[model samples]
Target chain A: MEPRSSGLVVLVLVCPLAAAVLLQLFGRLDRRLCMPTALAACLASLSLTGVLAGNVARGMPWVYHPGNWGGLGIELKMDLLALLFCLLIAGLASLVLVYSYRFIPHELAPRETSYYTVFLFLVSGLLGLSIAGDLLTFWIFMEVMALSAYVLIAIIDVPHAFESSLRYLFMGALSSLAILLGVVLLYGAAGTLNMAGVLGVVRAGANGQATLALALCSVGFCVKGAQVPVHFWLPGAHSAAVTPISAMHSGLVAKLGFYGFARFIFFVFGTTAAVGVLKMTSVLQWIGALSILYGGIMAILEDDLKLMLAYSTISHIGFMLLGISLLSPAGLTGALFHLLDDGLAKACLFLCAGIFIYRDGTRSIQQLKGIALRTPLTAAAFTLAAFSLVGIPPTSGFVAKWYLVLGTLQARRPFFAAVMIIGAMLAAVYAFRVVFYMFFAPERSGALQMDDVPPAMLAPAAILGAGTWVLGIAAIWILPHIQRFVASLVS
Target chain B: MSQALSYFNLTVAFTVFIAGVYMVATEHNLLRKLMGINLCGAGVLLLAILTGFVRRGQQLADGTVAGTNTVVPAMQWLAVAGIVAITAITAVGLALARSHKRVFGTMDLDEKRNGVKQAPPQSTPNATEDRR
Candidate 1:
């Protein structure tokens, strides 16, 4: 937790904000330069994250009091887990920016400089969400992120996009409202918004309203994470948006919900047997298991490529939830690992979908049959991502799934082990359905003439595909560390 | 005696919440459904205000430690602000819903199952045609 290391945290969070401001101030100077400028900012952040990751690997978390902000102003803290997620986000965001250079032309006009500005703003908010030390600050960053996302989704201006965006807005507002209520109640009981302070109170067995507040906050976070019944809006919103955005949304935005949940369980609720493990005392496991089954089945049935990917996201998220609900160290680590794996795999899938749309001007799986022959590299990337999705050996997805299964065994939750296996099988069905349909299905006459995706797009997809395996092989590299972090936080 | 007053607010809040949930669950009119969701917010705000009573203070003649303090008063004010903000937002939401319905000819999510089907009114096509 060196002071210098903490400085890197502030830089990571603020780089995007500063870039966003620059974009706003001078984005109009030369409209064509927006993409390159945004990419440069993202790349700079990625490099900063690489340095911070090394720092985190060496020691404890580094908390940078921005302007001595932890004492008075806005505090930025970067622990190992936060660093991992931030790096994942920044890295994938860099790729998305790379893709946007080519993809934006197909969907948006040249004067969409403001769009990139808001996009940068959204990234800044996500960085802030990952690292904020206080609940109030966390809530503020969450709102900024959610607001920017709403605008991004609605910007499609296509008919379904508007309605879906409206639905997403309503849902986002509800979650924010619920979170505010929970935070206020927590503040009322604990008399502080600081995570450490709240953790102290909850650990010391604060009763009555504070307990209720914890329950409400958990509910709010679950909604954000797209738990069942509350997840209806995600499919429409994800499917209807532009492709790179779909990738970013699936990869990063949903992880914020898991981050919030992690912060709450570890920081606010503590690892008390009552609150952490037995909090499920009634039906939490059932809820997680049911979502796993439901999201998987529905994903298999989906006809639209993007929509199926969205449902698969729901199913994959269910695995994370099941891992967390196990309330074991292995389980939490598994959940966290899956967050990384799912982000990369889902990003690859969405980018390929974008490539499909780019090539054929259609997103229907049936219409896309045998179209991958026209773009074998894209098809290969799809197969690798699908293998990752199905948790095949030698991919990051397998590492995540392995940990989750081991967690289920350690927790003595055999049913969840079976559920994870079933979820994986279902993932295989939907993921390969798209791939096989794209590559092997009977050829159709007069399909739109298509070309291989440009290097900018192919490069990101290939990197993510490779990362799926690299992370798998090196899963143990981070496992012990992530386990220690989660256990230490829970302890 | 004052407990009864707080209880009344609590009851009213719960009643509003139930009614709001009912509206949201049952209503079909798109605007009405949005209103129902909004009414649910009112209930939540009311409940938040009432929860302050779980630690209410009595007003004494000297107004010593007995009086409701600044914290509760501030939260009450914040709740009021929340109510106002949500109401204003509901109005904006209603306006957006109305316009969307006008543009699409329906607000039923089920009806728009296949997307906006009217083909975008040819989209001022000629200007873009020249470039292609």
Candidate 2:
């Protein structure tokens, strides 16, 4: 069992990494093998995550220590929550891999080698990040994730990709510095870097040093999370990447920031220290509120399809953070649920957007009229995803919004509830505008017949799009289990 | 001597940090910003090293005075840090060179944006109606 658990952890990580190397090797031998090889590797990791999730669910949180250092080894600790997030990371990457089968050669061409390689590196980094049990390893894996993301964005061979990737790299470095300093400060205060040890110190009413560490960590994570003032780099970076890369960045990578933030801030620092001593919860609440309004307004004003989706990522993640900041059980559950919901919904939307661009070779929304007539299934997926984004009933977006509203009311911040409602309305405005124009608006005269993307791409989009409804209905059962998890975590 | 070394590290770390912040905030030059980031990273690494020092009398499990008596080599940590930093810097540097050479047709660090760049015609079709 020991060998198996450790092997499972290493396998979960090494699968994608090995595939990255093999994909490069295979691509050199036969270009056609790249997609299948990449998909197989991602699927292997996904299946491993399922096993890890099962072990965690059976009340045995697997902790694999490579060196078996008595108490201080860098450990891959997978609690139920971490396993849940790992499932998301692995599942999302596998789908993106499927989505990229036909999309990559069409877009990346000769550069497909670097494209798939860096993408697998990113997936490995994200999986490693999901189970990070200490600050040192967390920072290491986080940089792995960030550096690969920078490379992914830059290698897309477009002028915009160049500028945006450079800007993103600089901003990313700043966030890393913040996180490093925070970790150093925390270790200084607590004399240990272990998550559980840090939690012990924080819960014992940590001194000024610990509070400062928390502050630095929040700033760093917020910037990486693309919370408003530091969020300028995100729209540029997300929109400029190729669409599949955009999905990975928006749907997967940004969630890393939130994961580290929650693991440290709430679970380690303890919410009371953050709220009472640091007076941070309210500050974060304000940041969340600002991001929601700002992201919504900007998204509504954007004309490019990918740009609109990029801004929507900002707005939806804002909703997640807002739920977290409420400091209520429902809020945390809602935040976690929204993490899964928004990630899949946005991925589906971006893939559908990619199909549109693939077919017409245009990204401007004005030129995308009557797309529903062109490809009914893809359009239907886009519309479902759009409705999910807008919080329509029986969709995951609605569930997230409902829980968040309840969280605010329970927190006795009725004003915050109002802000969320307003944000949702703004979301509906932008999302429905795209939907209306694409499906309802008249097609320009002389519109050529357009076909849906190949089943390779459409399968992933349809699955994720349908995931919008499945996850919403699933949330009713899922939230209570998440509540139990959050309850245990906070206690 | 140890006290002086600590003070020296503090002063240099902070000086570098501030200088980096100033460079990043005020300068539009891409090279300057990159330099700022490197400076900031140096300050941070230095600070981490500073935090590693054991106090004057804190001893090891074997009862020998720690850190003060003799240095415990952090070779592994340094090596790991070195590799990560070098990889990141190399990647970014190559990208900078590629961008400059590809776009401007020169290695000059100065941006050559003319007044025409200010108006910034929307290169993609119909992408620029909204100002908000």
**Candidate that scores best on TM-score:** 2
In model 1, where do residues sit more than 4 Å from their true spots? Answer: A1-5, A66-74, A273-278, A442-451, B1-69, B72-99, B105-132
Model 2: TM-score, first chain: 0.96
Error of 2 at B87 (Å): 4.2
DockQ of 1: 0.14
Candidate 1 interface RMSD, angstroms, 1 decimal: 6.4
Please report, as a residue range, the 10-residue window in candidate 1 chain B with the lowest summed lDDT.
B123-132
The digit string of per-residue lDDT tens for model 2 on A1-491 reads 22134558768888998998887666666767777787788889989878776656655678777666533435778876687788888888889988888998898777776678788888888888778777777777788788889888877666678778877887788778767767766765666667777888878875776887788788888988899989989999999899999999899888766777678776578777888876888998999999999999999899999999888888887888888888887777778888888888999999999998888898888887877777778888888998888889999989988888988988899998998999999999998888888778876444545565699988999999999999999887777668777776656
Least well predicted 10-residue stretch by lDDT in candidate 2 chain A: A1-10
Chain B TM-scores across candidates: 0.55, 0.53
Cα RMSDs of all predictions? 5.2, 5.3
Q: Which 10-residue span in candidate 1 chain A carries the lowest summed lDDT?
A: A273-282
Can you write out model 1's per-residue Cα lDDT over B1-132, one digit (the tens) per residue? 265774576468657855765775576556776777677677767666555433336542224453433334434544765666566546546655654665576676555555655523423322321142
CAPRI class assigned to model 2: acceptable
Indicate which candidate wins on lDDT: 2
